[model samples]
Target chain A: MAARKPIIGVMGPGRTEVHTEPVDKHVELALELGKQIAAHGWLLLTGGRNIGVMDAACRGAKSAGGTTIGILPGPDAMDISDAVDIPILTGLGSARDNINALSASVLVAVGMGPGTAAEVALALKARKPVVLLATNPEAEKFFSGLAPGLLHVAGDVEGAVTHVKGLLAAQQGGAAGGAEQQQQ
Target chain B: MAARKPIIGVMGPGRTEVHTEPVDKHVELALELGKQIAAHGWLLLTGGRNIGVMDAACRGAKSAGGTTIGILPGPDAMDISDAVDIPILTGLGSARDNINALSASVLVAVGMGPGTAAEVALALKARKPVVLLATNPEAEKFFSGLAPGLLHVAGDVEGAVTHVKGLLAAQQGGAAGGAEQQQQ
Candidate 1:
C-alpha cells in the first residue's frame, strides 16, 4: 500500500479588499506555499471557498500535480473552487474550522483575519504546530507573545516550508521513539 | 400544532480568566440575557462549553425553563455543560461557528475575541440580525461602522432583549406582508 501523505492545513482570509487588484501579493504567497507543500509530496487542506487565499492555495497545489481537499462550510458545492480535488461538504458552516485544525499535522496561516485567527487559536489549543506566514501586521502582532516552540513565524513561503518540514521530521522522530519505548 | 420558537444564538468567550471571580459580571450578564430570551418563549443556543459566557447563558436559559441547545466543537459530550438540554457534537472544531451563525435568526455577541469575532462576521455575511452587547471594546470598534439596519449595539441585557424582540417583530411583519402580497 502507498504511504499516506502528510496533510498540511492552510488558513487565511476568505475575503479581502486586496483581491480587487489584478495581483494580490498575499494570494500569490499562499499559492507558492501551496505548491511547495504539494511538491514535498503532501496533501493540502483549506477552507474550500472559491475566493481569496484558500482558492489561490488550492490552485497552486493543483498546478503542481498535488492533491488538495477543501472542507466547505456549507453543504452546497457552489462556493468551492475548481482547484480542489476532494470537497468535503461538511454542512457545519464555519464551525468546520475545528476539523481543519484537527485534520492536519501542521497549519500554515497565510494572513490574519478573524476567521484565520480563530483557526490559529484552535490549532494552538489542539496542540498542533502553526507556521505563520506573516503578511498582515495585525496577525503578526497577535502571535508575537505566543510561546516559541509550537508557533513559528516566517517571512516567506520557502522559510515557512522549511519550518514545516522540520516540524514533520521532529514529529516522526518522536513517534518512532515512542514506539521503540513501547517495544522495550 | 404549536408555532416554532425562534432560536437566539449567544456568542461569547469560551475560556476566560474572568471566570475565577466570585461572580463574573460577564457571565452574570449572559445568564440574564438567557433568562430573558427564554422568558420571551424563545430557544437559546450557545457553543456548549463548560466555561465562560456560553456556560453562563445556558445556565440562565435552563434556570428559566427555556430549551437550550449546545453546538459543541467536538464529538464528545465531555465538555458540554449541564446547562445544555441538547448537545450537538459537530466535531467540526471552530468551523462550527458557521453553524452557530446560521442556526439562529439573530445572534447576541457578548464578548469579542477571534472566535467571537468570526461568529459576528459569519452572522453578518449570512444577513442575520446581530445584536452586539458591547462587552468587548475591540468588538464594538469592529462593528461600529456597520450598516445600522440589521446590526444593533445594546448597552445592557434589557436593551439587547428589546432589540431582539423588535427585530423578531420586523421579521414576522415582513414575512406576513410577503404572504399577503402572494395571496393578492
Candidate 2:
C-alpha cells in the first residue's frame, strides 16, 4: 500500500439531533459509505461527531481498517467516535476550514442537506472527484439531464467502491506511464 | 419573512495564513450564497475560518443581514468571521461530522474535497434539498440516472441558488397547505 490513501469526503446532515426521530437507514448508509472508503484504501473525513451518520461512517471505516480523521471545532467538545485516527482540534476559531482536513482525490456524497451541498461545491472547486449515493428528490431533479460519465451515481456502497476503484486505476495507469517515460 | 430561509452551506479551500496568491472565485460564490441565504431568511453555516470562502460567505451573509454560524474543528483553530452570529466549537476529535455545523433546509454546495462530500451525503440522508454547483465529469457521472426531483444539479452558484429557491417555494407552499399542514 502507498504511504498515504486518498481522502474521501462524506457529506450529509448536521443538527440531526433536531430530527428527534431516528432514521435507522442513515446509519446503515453511512456505515456502508465508510466501509467503501476503507476498502478502497481511502481516508474518511467528516465533521468529527459521535451522533448520527458521522458516528456510523466512522465506525464503518474503522471496521474496514481505514484511517479516519476528525476535525473538531474546539477543545471542550464532547467525545468523537472511537474510529478517529487523527483528532484535529482547531478550536472554536477555525470552524470554516473543515474542508481542508482532507485533501482528497475524490469525494463521495451520501445523504446530504444544504450544508452538505455546500461542501460538494467546495470539492468541485478544489478539482476533486465527487460521487453521490442515496440522493434526495431535490438532488435527483436538480441533476437531471446531466452527463452520467462525469458524476458517477451509485445507489449503494459496493457501487461507490467500484466506481472509485475504476477512477484510481486510471490514475495509477497514467502515473505509471509518466514515470516510465521519465526513466527512459 | 418566510418561516425558514433555505440554509446554505459553504465549503472551500482555506489557507492557514493570508497568502499573496490571487483571490479565488469561490470567495465571491460563498459570499453570494450567504447573502442569498440571509436575504431569503435562510441560515448560513460554514467551517468558521477568517479566510477563503468562509470569510467571504460571512461577509455576504452579514451584508445581507443573514444568520451566520461557524463550527471550528480544532483546538488551535482561529476565530470565525465577524459576521458569524452562532459560533459552535465542536472539539470532537474527528473531521467526519462537520456537517453537524448546520441543519439546513436547502444545501448549496461549494468548492471543497472529500470532507465536503461526506457532508453532502449526510444531508441527503436527512432529506434536505440539495443544489450542486460546478458539475464536472466525475460529479456528473456520480449523480446520474437517479429518480427525478431528488437532486438539483446546477452549473454554477447562480443556478444553484435559483434551484434552491424553487425548492424552497415548493416546500413552503406544500407546508402551508398539504396533506399534512405544517410551518417551516
Best by TM-score: 1
lDDT for position B14 in model 2? 56
Q: Candidate 1 lDDT (Cα, whole model)?
A: 0.82
- Report the Cα lDDT for residue B107, model 1: 95
Model 1, span B1-184: residue lDDT tens:
9769999999887776325878767788899999999999999999999888999998899999999999998889778988999999988677778888889989998866556766776677566899989555444544443334567889999999999999989888888787765464
Residue A71 Cα positional deviation in candidate 1, in Å, after optimal superposition? 3.2
Residues A45-75 of candidate 1: C-alpha lDDT, one tens digit per residue: 9999888889999999999999999999898
Candidate 2 lDDT (Cα, 0 to 1): 0.63
| Cα shift from native, residue A29, model 2 (Å) | 17
Specify the poorest-scoring 10-residue window by lDDT in model 1 chain A: A139-148
True contacts reproduced, candidate 2: 0.05
Q: Which candidate is the best by DockQ?
A: 1
DockQ of each: 0.22, 0.08
* Model 1 lDDT at residue B183: 64
Q: What share of the true interface contacts does each candidate keep?
A: 0.29, 0.05
